[model samples]
Target: MIQVLEVKTEKDIKEFIDFPFKIYKGDKNWVPPLKNDEKKMFSPHTNPELEFCDTQFWLAKDNGKTVGRIITMINHKYNEKVNKAYARFFKFESINVEGGEQLLLFAENWAREKRSTHIHGPLGFSNLDNQGLLIEGFEYLPSIASTYNKVFYKDIFDKLEYQKENDWIEFILYPEDCIDERILKLNETIKKRYNLIVNSFKKRKELQPFIPQVLEVLNQAFAELPYVIPFDEKTGSYYIEKYFSLLNPNLIKIITNKDGEAVAFIVGLPSLSRAMQKANGKLSPWGIYNIFRAINHPKVVDLALTAVLPQLQRQGVAAVLITELQKELIRYGVKEVETTGIFETNTQAVQTWKNFKHIQHKRRRCYVKEL
Candidate 1:
């Protein structure tokens, strides 16, 4: 006996947010997301995605115990531009194959009523949220804020005939050992010749102005990117506030051209795997302390986002940033650098990693089915 409940009320939503606790009761690697963050991301009153999108969440139950959950989302702004009523699903978890199928069927019919052409999953409310399904590296514990799922999740999707549409590749780097002498000299020469200054944010207050500048450049540089919806002012601020707290000084490199304008940026944070595992994504009286501690002295560093201005893309400036960062990474005794997920088709970005012997350590895929 399986049933899926649409999370519409406060209680239902709370259950939806807490389902993972019950589902992964004994799983050691699973980390709980903070209840407050989950609330904000799903609630129209809090999530900025509500400005241009709509989403619904469901929790699956059998015999009065939670078994699975899923979030169905539709970005009006994206569907219109992409020329299809494409739907996305996220926060998916399950203990049974039949239950997962039933939940997905509900979403399929819902999208059909809206005349959607395709359905994709495990993506969050928008690109700003988590996107992609774990297709490889299930044995490795994921970084904080990075996604993890049971290996069987892939088998279920395969059983559904969903077409693989996109792949996001993550890399693990041995920066200390891979820095070539030629590349090192080239990095120094480029920095001096171009008069580009790499700014390292020392104090929390110092990052305030650059927050908007980085976001502005990110929005501008990645405007034409696929599946990226433009961020409103509020959402932009929220992103900065959430990230700067865990930043390591050398992790952020603000690339300023000779004119002193921020032309490029890369943002990385100390991994909270241990802390997130402890806090379970909650910032409550008990959890907040653990999360704060994890960020201050993190073992794994997750490179969440990176971008270089389009005008300078042809000149190979991103390599310069990486080369310098790699040296600092060695001095810092960093274990391994996690490259942000890059679209498999992004050859130029891939090439930058090749110079440093970066391995495609993880593969997350997006699957679609025509409704």
Candidate 2:
């Protein structure tokens, strides 16, 4: 018999976090998240989102062996903003269809008890968290910001009668193919026409003051996107502290208008997928060495985020930002550029990517089911 148990004890929490390590074993493309990071995410003291969200973790077991894990959440803030009673499921992993079904059923029942009318996810407390299920490109290694899973995991969602709520697509770009003489010239013209200035940083401290303004632009830029919530002051600070140390200053670019206010920004990181895999979810001496090595001599870069102020959309600000970042990537001798998820319906963003030699190789999905 299969059994689903709430993760209430310390041991249960460890099992919940460790379950994926077992499921993805021997899968060359899977990247393990840092174990310390996983622990912090579940703690209320560390993850500010826990202060406002109702959350629970669960483990599915058969014959006393762990088979699966899942998390159920209700973001009261999100529900109030969208004016809908919706719950979310995230960090879902399972060894087989049966284990997946049991864990999902438990989550559904719990959501109903909480008075939610519909449930959707592979989403998390906020957009900053990893969201979506891998629906395609299983053979390719996922970026540190993307999601990955066994192909069979989709079958469980199908059997549960869940339908697609949204889809996010990812791409791999060749910087050589993306560099265009016309765009470079256009960037110069656009900068002169709009009186926009591009800012590049060589040190983390130099980028600190602009952080708040960049996040404000990010809030305004993504306000209309699905599953978005604005970053409150505390939340923004938390993220800054969490990720600021990992960023390479050379990979960040910002654009300011004549008034010197940040209106657009692009953030990239040296691809740490291989390094994280080498770490095997631990920060051992060797793991720390591998991470620093990748940071210092990166060949692959992940374009993690780009945001343009709402009023500035279609004004070529984005193009200018990309051109500046492209120059830096070339200087770094970068070979491959991986993008985080872009919603499939975002035609403008999709078209922007097609300008380069690229492959829309990966797709992730958020599934929904009415309770």
RMSD of each: 2.1, 1.3
Top model number, TM-score: 2
* lDDT tens per residue, model 2, 1-371: 99988888889988988888887888899999988889877888888899888998888989999999888999988888899999999999989888989988888999999999999999998998889999999989999999998798899899999999999999998878347778788889988988899999999999989988998999999999999998988888888886787788999999998999999999988999999999999999999899888877888999899999988888888877777888888898897999999999998776655556788999999999999
The TM-score between candidate 2 and the true structure equals 0.97
Tell me the TM-score of model 1.
0.92
- Give residue 43's error in model 2 in angstroms: 1.7
Question: Could you tell me how far off, in angstroms, the CA of residue 241 lies in candidate 2 after the best superposition?
Answer: 2.4
Angstrom error of the Cα, residue 88, model 2: value is 0.4
lDDT computed for candidate 1: 0.75
lDDT per residue for candidate 1 within 13-94, as digits (tens), equals 8888777777776677776666776788766667777777677778888988788888888889888777778988888888
Which 10-residue window of candidate 1 scores lowest in summed lDDT? Answer: 237-246
